[model samples]
Target: MNEKLRVLVSVDLDGAKARVKTQGHVTLQSIQGLYDVMKRADSLVPGLALELDMTLAEVEPQALEELRGCARSHHLPLQVDPLQRDYRFSILAPTLVALPVAAPMLAAA
Candidate 1:
């Protein structure tokens, strides 16, 4: 499994804002990489406002919380796109529900 997280950074011509897009799974180990990229982007333009897009990525709950904390304490002026779904769930519960059930005749075919 490729554990690497890909980060793409873009800054506006005026250097007043920066946008970051992340792809791949974001685990505890990879959170640092994401933070570093954000820091670098901020340095490029002092007081740069950052917008983070994680729609293309899956982030572990712990990592997500840590990222939020870091951003809050550092005052990164970051705005993150909302996650599609909540990751916190009961261990006994199914990760997916309402799965399609194929017809019995189809199995025999």
Candidate 2:
């Protein structure tokens, strides 16, 4: 087994479950996307020890609260970044962070 950790970004437990369902045979690219999301969060918030969804069980409640506080302190969204590379990825595979495409409306007189 690889010592490297696995990351799954989801808005909530249910979304996380969906991701797990699709990961029968995960590739390095998938893992790298997870790593990138974690790295982005770390870079955005230095000196803030953190963990991904898979490791949440190991984090103390108080520390978790502090992490929540840090996120709030920075005014960032409570949700984690999707492991998706872009909107196209989300289109092909539904992800939590995907925004719905809006259709242009006709101008009124």
Candidate 3:
């Protein structure tokens, strides 16, 4: 059975951030709705960070990962509250750094 997806967007009074609350089941089929809501929120408050609260929503693991990937690729500051106490998930994007290579050691003659 297909579950209904509910998305609510609310911006802060200072207009510095927007909070998106989602309820019901969040699957691949309903991911577009979530994205649309986020897009609209971003347009309404350009340059502001978005916080996604999925505490009350039932989200598929794959869909959750996809959302994180999308947020990172788009450089969007998205904070997610999965509401699962057993496992912890970070919403912040990880920083990538290049390590220097050491010179190869010469064999003894």
User: Model 1: residues >4 Å from true position, as ranges?
Assistant: 75-109
Tens-place lDDT digits, model 1, residues 23-88: 777787776677667767766766677777776676776666666655555542243312221111
lDDT of 3 at 48: 62
**lDDT by residue for model 3 over 12-50, one digit each (tens)?**
849577878877777776877776677667666566677
Residue 80 miss distance in model 3 (angstroms): 20
User: lDDT, candidate 3, residue 59?
Assistant: 74
Report backbone clashes per prediction. Answer: 0, 0, 0
Off by over 4 Å in 3: 13-15, 75-109
| Per-residue lDDT over 2-45 for candidate 2, one digit per residue giving the tens place of the 0 to 100 score | 33334454333322222211222223334445434544544443
lDDT of 3 at 66: 84
Off by over 4 Å in 2: 1-25, 55-109
Q: Which candidate is the best by TM-score?
A: 3
Q: Is candidate 1 or 2 superior in lDDT?
A: 1
> How many clashes does the backbone of model 3 have?
0
Question: Regarding TM-score, does 2 or 3 come out ahead?
Answer: 3
